[model samples]
Target: MIITVAHQKGGTGKSTIATNLAVELKTSLLDLDKQHSSIIFNYKRAHAGLEPLDCYSIAESQCRFDGQRPVPEAKLDEFLDLFKGDPKTDLVIDVGGFDSPLNRKALFFGDYLLTPCAPSGTEIYGLQMFEEILQEAEDIAGIHLLTHVLINNADKRSQKRIAEMQAYVKGKPEHFELCQSVIGQRISFKTAYETGQSVVELHEGARTAKLARAYLHSADEMTALCAEIRHALGKGV
Candidate 1:
């Protein structure tokens, strides 16, 4: 399955979700974001003498854009020609938080799309705009884009905000499905990122018992989300 992790606004935990999925699933990661955050994280992991992730860089140079907009048909074909040629490989693409022709083209090739958004008014507005873009891509591609909107970095104490976000997503079932699994704003995630280790990779001695438990919980949440995503794509858990 080809999965694309994308959002138009930054700081929505796009890299966080992408890296976690890649590490947990042991899939190849295609870093299309200009920031190259995934690549850097993998490097950190490798430097730490840890097992490295299978990764590739699909730099912006490989894409052809007409002005600022990508010609969807050409871009879609380009991606399909390159990535779809390998039928057995599960690929994950991490796109930067900027709306571009390349990003739109990537969306068309995704068998499953995961968009992470924080619980905020601006982030919700960004999600709405992203849905419209996806709709436009669907029109251009003549196919329904399978998409899931993930609520990430949610505050554990803000039940009201989480409830509101859930309600908003429930009202827009046609645009994107809301993921039942959520990632909370926890310090363990930051610690794992800095060390180039996923929550699943953290040893007991590496963190306090409370933090280790938090990481374990986050890892379980991520695993459940991955299973849900695969099942949605008609793949076995």
Candidate 2:
């Protein structure tokens, strides 16, 4: 199963979602993002003596863009095939923030395409633009696709804002599906990643009482999200 975390807009916590989800699922990750965030995270994990994730990277130079947009490269199929060809392997891909031939191809090849959006006006606009791009990809591929929208970094105190965002996503049932699991804005997410460990792992070794409590909360949320994702994929709840 090829699960891709992608968004054409930046700062939507794409890498955060990808790294945490990959760790929780214990799956191989393909870092197509230009920043190579997942590759760096794996490096930290390896040095920290944690079981390093199986990670790979493809340089942006590999994709040739025509004018401003990327032109399809035949080698892309060969590259993606390395990850998607195996039916039994679960591959998690983190794509960059841009509309390009490479990203569009990833969307077409993905078994489940997930887009993380923060609860804000700007992110909503970006999501709308991504919807257009997804539509274009569908037109080219001759098949319809739905991008699961996960609300990330949600403020726990602002229930109204989260509700409004959910309604907006629910209004477009055909194009997007609102993920049942929501990831909140928590400090543990940042602190845990700095150590190259997921919240699930961090809670086990938390140094202080407050740290342990915070990590435990984040871990529970992450675990629930992973379970929801697995259930959606028909693996189990």
Candidate 3:
């Protein structure tokens, strides 16, 4: 399935999820939106340079916004055409922030849109807006929007805000889901991306590999969630 991790605000572990999830499935990644696809650097958290794990069949790269003027609507069609032949090969797209043209393309082309949200008020507002946008877009595009809301990257300060977020999404079953994984706060993820790799690749002898292990398991869970979402709705949901 073509899973697209997108968010209105940046730094919600979109790249990390896309990269590590590909690693979990041993599938290729089509990073069609990120300018850096930070998932490439897997050793940012390591003090000592660490050798990356064996390369998976991931097509890690950034989407080129080759336009002089503002972005047009046809960009979505162009990207969709590239993968029209195959959108169900364990594909993962780390779409850029919500406002980018590539993000629009991804939304139009995505089979399952995975939105990573924090519990902060600002993030909550963004998620609410995102839900509205998705609903309108789905109506316009004539496609079912299977967008899953996964809580991601909550620090001590943010933990207090989840109940509020939970309240906002209390009755929205068709639009949201509380993922089984918490993906608790961790700095290793930011570090790994800064160095062009995943945490698992950074240190097998990780004195503290708990975060890495959680991420791997979360990715596995995401796969199952994607399947469930597809089954519940139709393709291109």
Tens digits of per-residue lDDT, candidate 3, 108-217, equal: 77766788877778887788777787777778778777577777776646655876766666666666766645555666666556655555554443456675564554
Q: lDDT of model 1 at residue 94? A: 88
Ranking by TM-score: 2, 1, 3
Question: 1 or 2: which has the higher lDDT?
Answer: 2
| Leading candidate by lDDT | 2
- Cα lDDT tens digits, model 2, 71-125, are 2355667756766745567878889888888778889888888999888888888
Q: Candidate 2: where is the Cα deviation over 4 Å?
A: 59-75, 82-87
TM-score of each: 0.86, 0.90, 0.66
Q: Candidate 3, which segments miss by more than 4 Å at Cα?
A: 39-88, 156-159, 207-237
Question: Could you give the C-alpha RMSD of every candidate to the true structure, in order shown?
Answer: 5.1, 4.8, 6.8
Runs in model 1 deviating more than 4 A are 59-87, 203-211
Poorest 10 consecutive residues of model 2 by lDDT?
63-72
Clash pairs for candidate 1: 70-101
